[model samples]
Target: MKKYYLRAAFIIAVGLFISGCAGKSDLSLNIINGEKLEENQLLTTKNSIYLVNGGDGMKTTYLSVVYGEEIAEGSGLAAVNIANEQLCAYTAPVVLEKLVITEKEALENAKLNQSDYVIYSRVEKWTDPLGINCTVGYYTDEASVVLSLYSTKDEKLLNTTRLSKSSCPFKINNIPVSTGSAEILYEELFANWKNNMFAKVSK
Candidate 1:
């Protein structure tokens, strides 16, 4: 009788554990604030822009508790790279280079090159919901990035913009049963963000 009671208690404990785990919400990215750049606020072709990768807040495992596995693996860096590429494609007649050196070194380089502006960007959050709806699997990816623009001439912060984007459902239908990758979703999101940022530039 005692053994039977103990077994029942164990089963109840297991059930409770499972329930707790299931009830917990997975960590996801949320945009706090976002703004669009005005024509007067846009960077001009005469200005040079320096790209700096501030890196996401996930170089350590402890952050994983709040950021989850997807963000802790440095996927944010990939998003930064994508944003840099998109910026280069859209912004014409402007000098842009990815900063490979330290912040101080980059600043020195910018001054030497007579750069008008230095843009520093960092990924804040990234989330991918690999969901399925009948015939298609969707990578509903979301991301937030903070962009800071500094005037190299005055060495003062000109503006700070937080950009966030959520990708539409990417259709996946094939004989090989393939789902979309995170890269595809991030590409779409960053491209949209880049276009929106420089919308007034071309005008």
Candidate 2:
């Protein structure tokens, strides 16, 4: 009877832990930084048939979040927004997308197959995940994520920043925090990439 009671209690505790980690994390977005902007911009597309091509007369560059299989939820677009809003402001309301991969991969590959950019930056870290528990009393290890920009143009890498390891037990805190941190890192990384190698090949 005592053993059974202990097992049941442990199971309940585990259940609660799991719920705390993922139950509240409904969406991975809300981190893409372009929410507050003053001047919109023109569409950056070189050749296009889409009517949303230019001059919305707003400051918010309408950027769509890129959902990817290997995506870190809201990480990619969030970062991109941060960069867009800060770098060289425009009045044309540019359209941006968070991309795990762009559709113009073939063109990129053909042009910048030898680009030398490989900038990496760590945005956040947490570990032991929340799935495992031990006698160590909520002991979690250090896990980290890095934001990288591969310049498909000049092959130049920049701003390999590593953020501090976020002390989180699970997704409850880590997901949001990591998502925000990663965005900031990517924004910085891409901004520099623009100055160095971006938009050189695929424009």
Candidate 3:
């Protein structure tokens, strides 16, 4: 009888753990559009980069009352920071302060800066953690962004990556502490793309 009781408890615990984890994490990344980088094409030392914010506006939805455009702007800033952190190891990347909504604007900006390449990052969606719905149950925080790399010489797009991440917070002393953000997703996306580049070409 004692052995059976212990086994049942173990099964229950495992079930709860799996359910909790499944409910807490939701992440996706897709190449969606654009061609792949050619070997030894964009990784050359002579290629200078312009990192631009391509987000036009923030879609707050449920978070509109509590959070605002600042959240979306923060996401863009996070992307630029991550790109700079990763690309700087190879070459110094120029950070552009202007927000661009189209590829033409981004390419023009890059040309103005005399940059050979362009990194256009746009924040598409944002659902902040502290919304009215969060008070009732575990609220999922979601962020989505599109990253595109381009060649300024011919205004050709090299690659475009779209990624999204959503995670629910585990409580700490009755307070929900979120473990995910736009910054985290951007870091993962850029790091993976950079590694793939290094693998394909000598730089």
Best by TM-score: 3
Question: For each candidate, what TM-score against the reference?
Answer: 0.54, 0.27, 0.67
Per-residue alpha-carbon lDDT of model 3 for 92-173, expressed as tens digits? 5565655545778888878888898887888776555552233323344666778788888989887887767666555444
- For candidate 2, what is the TM-score? 0.27
Give lDDT per model, in order. Answer: 0.54, 0.33, 0.65
Top candidate on lDDT is 3
| Residue 103 Cα positional deviation in candidate 3, in Å, after optimal superposition | 2.7
Among all windows of 10 consecutive residues in model 2, the one with the lowest summed lDDT is: 49-58
Prediction 1 global C-alpha lDDT: 0.54
What's model 2's overall lDDT?
0.33
Q: After superposing candidate 3, which stretches have Cα over 4 Å from the reference?
A: 1-23, 42-46, 56-74, 98-102, 130-139, 170-178, 197-203
**Candidate 1 at residue 111, lDDT?**
85
Which parts of model 1 are misplaced by more than 4 Å? 1-38, 57-71, 92-106, 129-140, 167-203
Error of 1 at 30 (Å): 12
Clashes counted in candidate 1 amount to 0
C-alpha displacement of 7 in model 2, angstroms? 59
